[model samples]
Target: MLDVEKSVLYVAFGSLAEITIDQFRELAMGLENSGVHFLWVMRIPFEDEFLNEFEERVKGRGVLVKNQWVDQVEILRHGSVSGLMSHCGWNSVLESICESVPLLGFPITADQYWNARMVEDYYGVGVKVLTDTGSVRGFFSSECIANKVKELMNVECVKGKEIRENVKKLKGRGAAARSAMEEGGSSWDALDMFIDQLIFGKKKK
Candidate 1:
């Protein structure tokens, strides 16, 4: 990652999420075409020959981790990692915000859609891969992935610059959150009160 010139894109979906082989192929090709350095943590259990060939084709430009665990937070915190290709799970979103890594969200299901919307629309710290109809749901082709990946990774572009700026600001909020959990802070006081109540029961007014 240190050897990469600009910054590496880190890719991961949550543990249980799954995509069809076709979707996986499109995603892989899209990442390859985007012309960015990427590290993809592939957890989907599928036996496909294309996976090997794809890895060979990408070579130094991309790396795919098969059936393994990587420290996502550590990767986001690394200096060389500029963006995340994520499922937009709440935890992943929070981790990216805390680490100040911009997101390129490909939401799968459930709360992921809402989280992705918040990251892209509410916070402006990231972009969601959109379908042909401009909806985040529905089918995403290789072209869509390529465009969104390029959009998020290209800091010189207006939208990308805005996303990066937003992320920088959100990083400050993340710091404030950490401080609030520390001694003498509001979160700390709240926790202390809760613990006291749990231990001794609430006193009558």
Candidate 2:
């Protein structure tokens, strides 16, 4: 379904997000309104019937994967996936960073809010959706979702450019950290120290 190269927005709400039906509809509408190509991973209990009309409306531009387990890392690494709309789970955030893709954070609960803040505030790699007034987990309007998606994907926008640059730099740092675990590197030295401590304890026994 993701045929285009670097042209699709990839969306998933992790494994535990409890989205109300209304909120789901709003997200569907927002994706439609965004006018960008997308690949949405829908969890079970949400039937294709719920989005039949939406699918029909966005036939050529959108692809929906329903009630199926997918290799998220593979899809994120694909050239067709340009951005991620995620629940800001740490694993998802790191995956996006490693792949050098920007984010559209829709955090639900737990540490997700903090992750979202880090993405937008600390890391400068994403934007968060606004919650409804007077409600902690209330629905955000489709318009807000559409606008944020557009802003994040707009290459000419300052924020978009910053996010791209930030993720690129972060990816480089991650690569260096991984390389540090090789022979004669700092991480290798730390591992050797840990092993020596274990051996010393055994000898004392």
Candidate 3:
């Protein structure tokens, strides 16, 4: 992990989304094939023999955290973390943007699809991992996962660089948002006004 700068990829699908053991196998194989250092935080508890073997094979380069709660923000903030392979839930998208870490979106269900599009198409801070059938949401192959991981981690490439730059810009905007909530900022002023109204009742007019 220390061999490279901004070389690690962090992967997590939200707890709400359920994935089968087969999908997990593909993700493991793909991350290994990508040859990128990765930390995958999984909510599912897979007590499978194959997972044990897979972990040993990718021992030094990849880490699998199963059925555990990790401090996701802390992981994203690490200097070695370059990208997040995520389900593109709204909170995950915002966290990636705030940390300036580029995203490799793998939206599964519900509003995740919309959020993934916003990350990829609208904000341009991420790239979507498409299925074998070229659909945005569905079962995806290990090859597809490998290709997308490589694409996101390839900083020398045009697309990867563009996404990195975009995420940086988005992170700046997030900073500005924080400032807006500080004292004397617009959000502060609005909240002050609201509190005054609640305490005094409509300003007597």
Give me the candidate number with maximum lDDT.
Answer: 1
- Give the clash total for candidate 2: 1
Highest-scoring model, TM-score: 1
TM-score of each: 0.85, 0.81, 0.83
Q: Which digits, one per residue and each the tens of the lDDT, describe model 1 over residues 116-188?
A: 8898889999999988898888778999999999999998999999999998888779887656757986777
Worst 10 residues of 1 by lDDT: 1-10
Rank candidates by TM-score, best first.
1, 3, 2
List the pairs of residues colliding in candidate 3: none
How close to the true structure is residue 16 of candidate 2, measured as C-alpha lDDT?
A: 81
Model 1 has an lDDT value of 0.86
Model 3 regions lying over 4 Å from their true place: 1-4, 176-205
Q: Across residues 1-205, which tens digit of lDDT does each residue of candidate 3 receive? A: 3334699999999778887788878888889889999988887647878888988998988887888888888888889899999999877877778788999998888898888878888999988988888778788889999999999999999999999888877877877655666798677777788888999876523
Worst lDDT window (10 residues) for model 3?
Answer: 172-181
Q: Which pairs of residues clash in candidate 1, taking residues 3 or more apart in a chain or in different chains?
A: none
Q: Give per-residue CA lDDT, model 2, range 1-205, as digits (tens).
A: 5698877899998878888788898899999999999999987546657688888998899988887888988898898888999999877887788778899999888988888878888889888887656222557899888988888887788988888888888888766654565687677777787787797853211
Error of 3 at 78 (Å): 0.6
* lDDT preference between candidates 1 and 2, better one: 1
